[model samples]
Target: MTELMLKYFRKKQQEVQTEKIYDTQCPFCSMQCKMQLIEQSIVSRKQYKTVGIDNPTTHGRVCVKGLNAYQHAFHKERLKYPMLKVNGEFVRITWEQALEQIKDQFTRIQDEDGLNALAVYGSASITNEEAYLLGKFARVALKTKYIDYNGRLCMSAAASAASQTFGMDRGLTNSLAEIPYTRCIILAGTNIAECQPTIMPYFEKAKENGAFIIAIDPRETSTTKLADLHLKVKPGTDAALANGLLKVIIEENYMDEQFIQERANGFDEVAEYVRSIKLAEIEEITGVSINQIRKAAITFGKEETGMIFTARGVEQQTDGAAAVRNFLNILVATGKLGKLHCGFGAITGQGNGQGAREHGQKADQLPGYRLIENEAHRTQIANVWGIHPEDLPGKGVSAYEMMEKIDEREITGMFLMCSNPVVSNPNAHFVKNALKKLKFLVAVDLFISETAKLADLILPTSSYLEDAGTMTNVEGRVTLREASCPCPGEVKHDWQIIVEIARVMGKEKYFSFSSAEEIFNELRLASRGGIADYYGITYERLRKEGGILWPCPELDHKGTTRLFETSFAHPDGKAVMVVVPNKSVVPKEEVCSEYPLYLTTGRVMSHYLTGVQTRRSPALAARNIESYMEIHPTTARKYQIVDHSLVKIESRRGSIIVRSKYTEEIRPDTIFVPFHWADSQNVNNLVGEELDPVCRMPGFKLSAVKVKPVNDVNI
Candidate 1:
């Protein structure tokens, strides 16, 4: 495998010398750093070399993952054809045989077990057009209500909080260009320096202009290193810290009373709740000092224009929705929103996280970010598809819940696309077992991932470079991804595969998209009047303008860059401030004598999610060969463990052996592990499946665990 990868990289390097580089965006993270892919046709084999492109987001900058992303297309493990599992062994099969088998099995499952028995698990990495088609195929073809995507695990809580507060969910309310102009910026739970490196420069510019940057996290991350103040709060205590800051802001008379009285609702109720949180209690609940909270409150409140940003760290908690709401409440009370250089939002992680949610890959959504249960939304979308409104199914369970139901036969068959839940899901060991209970599983991906390994049939799909589609970035910018090379071997584009299956299932009228452009054209009409309206964004416009922000309602209208400037999306045009009482950070499975440490999982700069694509790149693998636990020096000393010593981190759920790196960056009572590796090194094995009630986002950040020397354990 290594030799094959090396040979491919060598050939790519040699071919790049004589090939044309096509402009495109990175497939790694939501920063969507624009880059150019040089298509090289060496002899008869095709390869690519990635180069940075000058764009508004990156300005010709690319990270390690972006620079090496081209290698994923030519990896040794690239699936070249369709295969079916026969007697525990996969055998190469024709596309017709695979499609027929899927049609027969899916038909039988629905006929016998009903439509609810079949499920579709989509992806956040696919194009908006592809995601829209998958949702349509699930409802109109297979007729399943159990449809969701991996984004549920990452951005659902943020989405829920945004919608509940502002009546619409788009990760950011302002453009990335405004970051440097804000007087203050508070980042909760996100490590932009490592996770989204291109964004760091904007924060740096803010600091250069005397802006106070506060980083609220338990660990001292690359982002924290740039902070004016680091509020090292305890894990899962984000709500308390936010409420505490609000308390100080209110007591000190720093709030914008005029703005609050004019543009916000429920301020009195939320302010009363904030007034109830005592500073002493806040210091105890969150691990930060009362003085630190006061400093953060004063810096944030004094600023005329500021922004509050969050990511998975706060959004992956059991109280994630509450945390996000409380965070937004601070902004609303301070009158920091609806103005230039001021806003509150999340830094989306996946490549197309914003677009995927808008286009209906989520369980509870339809095209144009409409609710699946809404009769009007159903009627509107059904009319566009030339189907009856009654034919549309109701809202389904979320991704994690869908997985749990698989063991109960509620969801007997699943079509998994562009995701590897076995390595990415919380409580991964349990997820793997639940996957085994499926009657039939169809995996559509470029490689045979750990999740794909359990599939009844696997279909090889083209990589991002071989597909033409649109992807919305973190700032809600709609960008184009152009096809620069032909797919390898018999591999097909994901949209083509979905259309073929839909045709085979006798839904040809609805799935007659000959090209991505045709599907995108339909998407424009479906999203015409919705919050994420894309009617004004065409492929030609995207090409000419580099990118365009959403809510562009007409061809002549320029896209909206700053949302909620004069009015919000709510009917009353007022931001809603929800008041949620403080909750404990400890999980239901509390820390005890046997398992006394708080375990948190996060990402590293070198590798992307689950290590599916990045792991294939030799450059990335060489930077971080395997996963290791980051233990505080005090914790390491107490446990009698040295740096680089192998240790067994065990939880009630499962255990894994990893090398320990002692550092002062993490709290003494907490351990941090990167959840990129599979098998024993997979940290999700130690994570609990406690989900946020409102959004169904799992608490991937906090778990109870115990660590000891590997030699001391009887393995």
Candidate 2:
């Protein structure tokens, strides 16, 4: 046979001999794209191709990161076997020995100190069952109430405000899938283009439907490019812009007076308060024109139906809670409550941030989205736990505050599960130091992460592909199923690991669940008739429907796609219109000559919230390996730094050496940096712990820094 013919025949044979279908979701971000693995060759692992399924929530589109999901599963850094750090290096150890040692040390600590001295920190990536088990293990087994998740950094402020005003801290009232029905969509502080790319279609469709779209951000990003009006406001001036819009809404009489009088409260006070905020005065503070605020407000308030969405931008500031309240004021005054397409929504960052908060991992919240401090909520959760709610600690410090108090010996022991805070946490230098001061540190990770390197006992855990669990997306849709692959090496599922540790600590009674299904059933019962109101959903119903929205707590109830369609969740069935005044919370009052540039840091589309999983992917690394500082071309010229040249960014907190990418995408006096790189060069190292007063979220953005050319070409 001819050589070409022989080659063609061999290729055909290879395809036929390759492995069959393997099912998995894109591991990069929360918009989990279900993919099908197609065999390409005999020896090589199957490559994934996105299934042409009928699911249109994301419109059958995937981002650059989603297309490369296999990279994380097959990465060289994956924890293949259990290892124990002996002396200064990690050494391979059997699962039996590692578990035995962890049990011994943790038990000894529990006997020596008290339960409050030991804390267990879980993650938003894990399923609700895993989170509940971890918290139960900490409280019942180790007898500690200091259990929290990393969601505190992602959505605590918005959750706090929503709970206060709406009587429920559940997910967004309107699903992103329902965005098409709106006449106007206002996004504040969220860069949906770069993060949460799956929902980009919703914003695009809103634009296509002639819905007025406004983006309020300090930086002009990809999402801002498509906005009908882009307000490049100053840092911490979100409330100013929001109030300025509300001022225009009141002055112009664009609100639905009938709805306000019938279905809302505090409108008179909100109007009186908004009258005090002059549009012209706020323009000076927000760096936006008075006309722009009026234009956005007119379009939004006058629309038949509108939805206002805010993300970490408004929720991560010093007055993040007020910023959220400001948006609520606009909606309530405009009479946009209790409707299908009109309300306020928060776009959460983490995959399971909503679920984790809903189920009982937060310091101030209990199961069923109830408050731990509220007597009624506490009583509900206490009933489920078969203990007095008063017996539980009232509330603990937030994630950031907890780290701050670590050195005071307030937090003696820590069990970090499925999270790498040393790399992702703001002010890495401070967090690393705090972890060092802990008397006992345990980390459960799929890799030997930087955070795990500091652990006294590390638990090797299975990845999402090797376990069965559910993850709630940003839109409050719950995706269910288990992995199709065998559990790799000696790694165990997070729940199984928690169960083992709980048994070792003599808390075996609370960890009696045989599978995630059994635990999820109990969670459904706890949430019955509660704020999240998952009384209609059941494990059996979930399997039959493939997916189901919450409030489907029972067998016969239909799920709700839009919230507050007829009645508001607040008292008197009316939404409250808060009188939000222009507030500024930027703490760095003055910028010295040494640090003249204002720095703003965030995530990119190609990487996850943190680069713990994405950084290990060669394809992702090839896209953007080293960190690069984004500065205006004029600023780069002033410093005599060539494009792509190495530079050192220094702040009062710390310093990092990174390359400079001179671009017009940044503001003149501001610089933008991606907060994904994990190393000394990480941009987060330069961010201080000075945080949002209401939310306790560190100021990852809005910091002063100085950038200078680095002569060393290798840097």
Candidate 3:
């Protein structure tokens, strides 16, 4: 360890002398498993070991990602100080110099090209306090409408669908504890066994209790192995399969007439539209048997209580919003929701994906899921911040659209924090080019991520363990993140960085804050009357109750655990039944003689999104060193490719070379690649930039490509 490391750890040790263990939540996924970091001394270095804590979400279970999270704080590559790009080379700089440069550049951009030239991109991993402050800083200090976060890439499709159908956007309608009591579960798109391992116990328990599980995917995963039935649907055809299931439920007279007539609207139109599709046509489009579709529909419709859960597999496509709505159609038509242990939801991927979308981080949203275009909402938030409604900016484009127009001079400058778009964005090669077209770029992170490498200014920020705040999990539960460790060198909390920048920009009146707790108090005032109300929550209450769900409007009110038990959030007290058409599973770059295979991207068990922080951990990196393509044995044989053979995958967007792992788990006409690697192994290079019409989510799950043995091609 270096002198700086020793100084950092010694200070942290002194602060927590009376307490040997500090409780905190995992920084990886939405499970938010509770864990205790026990202090340890190794030679001259101070270390902490992660142990599971008894909590409602995980019941004292921890995943590999949670156990290895401590390794990130002391990694050799951790950024310790601020730096500036001088003549294409990064040079050490003071915080004063860095903030001054950012303020000057922001002022110059706004003066020269107008406020639309400035933008800020936040993260979903940070606390709700930080996310809220970042949004305020963007709208008030920088006065720019172009502000968004990485959650747009993860859960925007589901959010859009849920809001339009249910009058709100929450990932789950009930808690994870209720999974075991459900009679049936329709698991689609998400492989919870690998992506969120802690939640797998609930599914296992449900299966043991005789609950029928239907796993729908194009590949056989750990999740599929646990299912009673696996529907190998073709990529981009999820909406069609869902529509087919709805048709089967209607034809068999499984529709609950009372529920449809009293608790929902627009069912007759949806039924009429689904009746036009034949089961055989759906089988041809989705590559699933008609019998299998009928069996699954019967299981779902006949069950007294059931649930439907979806994830990125169906949420990252061109028809993602429609696919999600169609899945909900079955639940609404069969009277499956608004009952005990029955609902439909999307499994959120990020740590604070639910909270980030609920707050003002999204381009078209205000605090507490309020629309930015709504004059009343703008006035409410503006009043809390001591500003007029007219001072607030209007809605801007989504994350993908913002990046797409960068080269066209729509976005000239950006402030990026805690997000690495270079490794995570679709059509990464084009994103790289778009980033370069920006006149100025500032990145605030704990390490020099791939996206930070392109920044003109890099500001060192504290990690989750070194900061204290609250985070909302997938179930809409807000939990606490304890500041267990000390920030090294001159690193500062993200909220403090935004505050200092705003002060430097002559917005001190609005940005004044002594602590994160103070910011949370203000956030509660801003969210009092909105959909995701947080007025009743407090730091003391969270510590005493473990975690609290949203819509706790009064101080005496307990948090709501299950929503829509009797009535929906809509003024009419009913859910909307949308009639979605069965669209074809065709990519913009269709398969041809040159490119005959379908390519899809996903995550692996050992790493999180983009592998920015996980890649630094020796344990995680050792488990998977580089990206590999998974191909069916028959496809490999047809291409003259053997197991572990190097292959070059070419698409209309770009190409990448990766080692092929032959397996029978995947479909014969499609291949799978993990999108966690950067540089030469980046799978996003081969992904197209097509956006979903409703949510603007990039179609990352489908791209037409062809594979060739590396030996047959020259380097």
lDDT of all predictions: 0.90, 0.76, 0.89
User: What overall lDDT, based on C-alpha atoms, would model 1 receive against the true structure?
Assistant: 0.90
Which runs in model 1 stand beyond 4 Å of their true positions?
A: 1-17, 39-48, 584-589
lDDT of 1 at 606: 93
In terms of TM-score, how similar is model 3 to the real structure?
A: 0.96
lDDT of 3 by residue, 591-663 (tens): 6798999898888889999998889888888999889999999999999998998999989888899999988
- Clashing residue pairs in candidate 1, if any? none
> How far off is residue 28 in model 1, in Å?
0.7
Worst lDDT run of 10 residues, candidate 2, spans: 48-57
Tens-place lDDT per residue, model 1, 589-632, is 56789899989889999998999999998889999999999999
lDDT of 2 by residue, 1-715 (tens): 9999999998877665555566555554556555554435455544545452334346456777766666777677788777777886788888778778777777777677766778878788888788766665665577676777788878877887776567665566866666877898899998989888877887788789888889988778999998988888776678888888988988998988988888777889988887876778898878889888888999997888998888887887667777788888788777776687777778878877877778777776667777677898777766776766667666766776777667677778888898888777778888888999987787898777888999877777877667777766666767664577777677788898888877766667767878888888777777777777666776676667655666565678767667777767787887766666576454533357988888888788778766877887778878888888888999888888889988988888888888888778667778888888777678878877776666677666667888888883335
Scored against the true structure, residue 417 in model 2 reaches a CA lDDT of 90
